[model samples]
Target: MTPTLSEVTVGDELPALTVPVTRADLVRYAGASGDFNPIHWNERFATEVGLPDVIAHGMLTMALAGRIVTEWAGDPGAVARYSVRFTRPVVVPDDGVGTEITVTGKVAAINEDGTVKVTITAKAADQAVLGGAQAHVRLP
Candidate 1:
């Protein structure tokens, strides 16, 4: 069921989403989003550009965070506005551990139209990935 606007509070926490940042994942995201940035698909280019490895698209990580909120709110269209800062690069690896995105949200303000300004704290594997991630959502 969709959550009512009045049901959310100032310190509500959204469930965490763990996504593996693999080389294949980056390649697929690049194709899907039309963001074939070398840093996200070419290891040699990424290394030449001083990145650790082929990095995942920033938008991909942001989309994961958005999923957390949209799932909690029970409707993707309920999200009126969403934004995040790419504080760190999501490096794709051939093996070993992957990244984890955890989203904790708080109601910053309630609008006259029943929309809520949500302030989200997004982290990746315990590191702050996106600071000041926020969304304006109209709850059912």
Candidate 2:
């Protein structure tokens, strides 16, 4: 159910989400997004480019992180604005398990217009991967 304005409060934390990203996902994203950057699927090229291994697409990570707010609001259209800074690359190894992305969010404020601001943090391997992540969302 969508959260009401009265049910939300500043400093409230949303449930955490962990997603396992695999090499197949990168290939699919590459095909769908036309972002066939070698670094995302080629470990050799990634390491040559100064990256530890194949890294996930920044937009994919952003979308995964945004799931927290969307699921909380129970409506994708309720989101007004979302922003994030790519601070660190999420390194994905060739292992079958690949890597995991963890997302967490906290309510920063309840606006006068029945909107709420949420601060988000995305991490991989216990290291932060996104900075200044926040979302503005409308609630019922």
Best by lDDT: 2
Candidate 2 lDDT trough over 10 residues, lowest sum: 1-10
Question: Candidate 1: where is the Cα deviation over 4 Å?
Answer: none
What ranges in model 2 sit over 4 Å off?
none
Candidate 2 structure, TM-score to reference = 0.97
Query: Which candidate ranks first by TM-score, i.e. highest?
Result: 2
Task: For candidate 1, give the lDDT of residue 59.
Answer: 90
Clashes of each: 0, 0
Q: What is the alpha-carbon lDDT for the whole of candidate 1?
A: 0.78
lDDT tens string, model 1, 1-140?
56797787766656655555677777788889899888987789999989987777889988877787788788999999999888987677656554556667777888887788888776765777787789999897
lDDT of 2 at 17: 92
What pairs collide in candidate 1?
none
Worst 10 residues of 1 by lDDT: 93-102
